[model samples]
Structure formats: C-alpha cells, structure tokens
Target: MEIDAIATAHAKRLSVADALLPTPPNWDAAAGTELSVRDGVALATRSRVDAGSPEALWRPLTEYRLNVRLGGADPGAAFGALLTEWDQLLEESEASDWDSAAVVTRPSRDTVGTSELLRRGFAPTRVLAVRPADRLAGGPPEVPGVRIRHAEPSELNTLVRLQLELRNYDEQFGVLTRRTDEERALTSATRELLADADSALPSLWIAELYGKPLGFVQVEVPPAAGWADSYVAAGSAGYLASMHVAEEARSSGVGSALAAHAHQLFDEAGMQAVLLHHTLANPRSTPFWYAQGYRPLWTSWYRRPAVQG
Candidate 1:
C-alpha cells in the first residue's frame, strides 16, 4: 500500500475542495482487499459485507463494496477506470436483488468523477448534513394540544415501532438497505439496552397529541457521540441519530417541533455542530431538514446490485 502517497493525495484534495470535511483517517490500516488502477496511479479496496454481521443488520443483504482512493493524478479518470473494473466483477458475481455497490466521497471536489458514476446508474441517495451550533436556542415550537417530553421506559414498544417506520420510509430511497429480520434484531438490542441499569442511553423524546405518542427524535451528545465526535473538523459534535413521525401526523407541525426541541438540547449540550444522515430522494425530509438549518457535508453515492450498468 502506498500509504504516504494515498494520504498525501487525500489531504491535498480536501485542502482545495472548499468543503467542511474533516482530516482524513490514516490510510495504513484501511480495511479491505487492496487493488490498484492505472498501474497504481489510483488505488481501491473490495470488501463483501454480509448481512449476517451485527453492523450489516442495517445494511444491504450484501454490499460488494469497491471503495476508491482517487488520491492520485487525474482523479476523474482514476475513478472511471476503478469503477469499470468493479462493474465487471459485479457482472460475474451471483448477487441478490437487495445487494448494492457503495461509494462514499466528498461532494465538493469529488464531483469531478461523479459524472461517470451517474452515467453508470449510481444515485446520490444519502447525505451527511451538519447544523452549526452557534444559532439561537429557544424552547420547543408550540403546537396547540401537543406535548413534547422525554420518552418513558414503558414506551419501548411504541418507540421501536416509530423507529421501524422511519427505517421503512428511508429504505425506499435505497439507503437503509437491511434484511427482513432487522426489526427483530433491533428490538432485541433495544430491549437489552433499556434493561441494563447502567447503560448510558441517548436523549430520546416523544411528541404526543391528545395523550397519544405521534413522533420522536433521538440525540447523542459529546463524549458519548461515538463516531460523530470524529467526523467534524473542530470542537465537540452531537449526532441526531434518528427521528420519525407517524404517517397520520405528517405536516401537522410535529416534526418541526421535535427538531426545534432537539436543537435546543444540542445548544445546551455545548455542541459545536449537530450531524445527521438523511435520504436525498425523500421529497419531504430533504426540504424539511434544509429549513431546519442543515446542509450537506458529504454525499454518499451508490448503485445497487453493482450490475445496473
């Protein structure tokens, strides 16, 4: 592996991209089966992620990933060649309809190669959005007859159902790929976590109307934000892990109220920013999140089954 070369290339790209991407991770121990393109002018890795893995529960049944390192010269050409090779491999592999080929890249400078990606049927389906923390903090948005409060331990079933509904809605955009048993596994995990007396859970709140829970949002603050703390360029960050609104309650101000509440909490926690992932194809959420002060920090490109080309 040309670790130094790859790192230097990536750092150079980010430095000139004019985006808010964070420092690149060390390339020496990047996981996957390493491969080269254009005689190592470009590098990549292939990894087959199985659905049975714990992390894969929220991923596609199979993800034959070909992650690229277009850190070399003419990244546009490098990406094109690397993807062509990956497509050829997809043609020979036995794959399920649910399987997908995934690529995650910065949208600013990496847009140079994405035209080829789009031509081959890849979709920019997901975005990592960031909301800066210096904004004014206020109490929850007021909606007549609506109450916003922390979720009770007994509302576990309702909470799980709402989350599943969220996953179902997001999956239509081809981003939340997962197995039929995802709900089963997720429920068990949630149950175990809730039952643990010492477990530090994220702050979860529910919106209720007429005493019936109708929506919910979840947030993880610094020191416990897991991966989010490292993804930002500076200071502590908070993660808006998940949010969902009941179908019967869409456009009833439930979502906006929940978002305002979450922002207040994020501000109080002293977060430098709040991060989240949302499907770009969702007409409703795409604009809603934008109105809530979030903008794209990274766009994840994907082509399902890898055989579409």
Candidate 2:
C-alpha cells in the first residue's frame, strides 16, 4: 500500500495501455511516472463534475480515476482487489461525494479490467485522440462562398453565440447538463478568454459563407508542463479545444474547411501533434474525427448518476 508500490502498479498499467494503442511520439512516459499516494493509493482526480444541474443533483460530484494494471499472476483477483480498495477508500472519506467514477485503459480484445468495469455498471463515455500535425495533407479546401479567418475583437459576441449553440447540440446527447447559472458562467469564461491578451489557451476561428457566419473552431498551443504522461506530446501539441458547424452547413464541407485551416496554422507554428476529446455516443463526432486522421489514445469509461448502491 506504499506510494512506491502504488506507483509501480500504476506504471505497469500504463505500459499495458500504451502497448494496446501505442503512445504517440509527443508523449513521455516519465510524466506518468511521477505519482503521489493518499491513504495508500495513487489516485488521479480527473475533473470536478459541474455541468450545470442543481447543486443538490450534481454538486459535490467528482470522478475518481485510476489506471488498472492487469499483468500479474491471477490478474483477475489483482484487479478485483484494486477495485475493492477504491470502494473502501470512497466509503472512508468525505471525498467520495463523487457522483461518478471513471478510468481510462488500453483497449484490448480481451482485458480483465474492461470486463470488470462493464460488469460493475461503468460504460465508455468519451475518447481522447491524437494526430500528428504533419499528417495533415493538402490545404484547407475551397468551398464556394466560404471564407475562414481568425475572429476579430469585434466578433466576440458571435463567438459566444456559437458556443451556446454548440452547448445546445451537445445537450441533446446528454453530454452537458449545466444549469442556467452554469451556462452563464460558461459565457463569462468565454468572454474572459476573449478579453485576455496574454492568454494562449484557445484562439477562435470563424468560418463564414458570403460574409455570414457558419461555424467556428477553438485551437491552442498547449503548455508542455501542464500535461504529464497524457496522450499528448509535451511542448509540441496544438489542441483543438472545440469546433462546431451550424446544422445547415454540416454537409457543405464547412467543418472540413475549418479543420484544414486549423491544421495549417498548427503546422505553421511547428506543432507536432493535435489532441482533442469527443463523446463516443455522438454519432456525428466519432466518424468525423476519425476521418480527420485522429486515433484514440485514451477512452473514458463512466456511469452517470453515480450514486452508491
């Protein structure tokens, strides 16, 4: 139960996961090597769930995450032991106010951890994918009457409106559940992004046809220091934070044109890779991302309404 022992266990789990899908060149194993143990377990807090529901319904919610190493004698029992320990830790701490728990593992045709999670009421929710910037081919396609450009300061309101629309689209798939206040909070956050001159978090790109808005993409040059042992390569990644095309423009190649432009910018900036997350449940997302040359680096498995039985 020592931290060293837990780190070793986690390392083994990461190796197995990497082997399943192969970590991209931009990622470093050393990032995953650094770990701290609490209560005799190495735990990684993925995020706080604040999707906008009533505080009573979703407040105090978190996702407790871990990587399950499944390569020991009696692998089944070993995984079971880890799960038991995790459940016990939850029972013993106020931190367990979690509404759900999650884990990302390598995909294998057959893996004990995958089966165990499935049986224990968890489901795969999101996928994290990466593609090398150099892999982007050709130029941004030319669409009749379509123009792509970075957003000007005067267009912040339009960007916010587009984001709201994107949020609405995601809500249809049950991916976002923000309350009105939370939605307004998101708007405030986006506005701050627009106002910050020193911020490198995400740069907005707008696509217009005949001088009318059609879609937008948010891109960023990610700081290498922030991502340790993540699927992304440190210092060399340009992240596609978000992208959306209006419903009427979906089949008209606006998304592709915008993506191609984003890739071109990243390539010009000398980025080696691009990373993004998309929900697997959304039929429109999965195929579109894959077609753009992205492959899964990590898969998030979850169970919603994560209440303890």
Top-lDDT candidate index: 1
Model 2 stretches with alpha carbons more than 4 Å out: 1-60, 74-76, 91-112, 172-175, 196-202, 224-229, 233-235
After superposition of all CA atoms, the RMSD between model 1 and the true structure is 3.1
For every model in order, what is the number of clashing pairs?
0, 5
Name the weakest run of 10 consecutive residues (lDDT summed) in model 2.
Answer: 33-42
lDDT by residue for model 2 over 1-309, one digit each (tens)? 554454465455556555434332322334332222232233333446455533422222565565544444455555655666665555554443334444544443225456767776667777777777677767777898899976777887777778777777675543355455755665566666666677553377789977898899988774632352355544577778789998878888888888888888888877777777787788998899889988877777765544356
What is the C-alpha local distance difference test score of candidate 2? 0.63
lDDT of 1 at 263: 91
- Compose the digit string of candidate 1's lDDT tens values, residues 174-275: 867757677777777666545655535446788997688999988887666858855667588889978889999888888998999889888877888999
User: What are the C-alpha RMSDs, in order, of all predicted structures?
Assistant: 3.1, 5.7
Please list all clashing residue pairs in model 2, or write none if there are none: 26-233, 51-177, 51-178, 52-178, 52-179
Q: What is the lDDT of every predicted structure here?
A: 0.73, 0.63
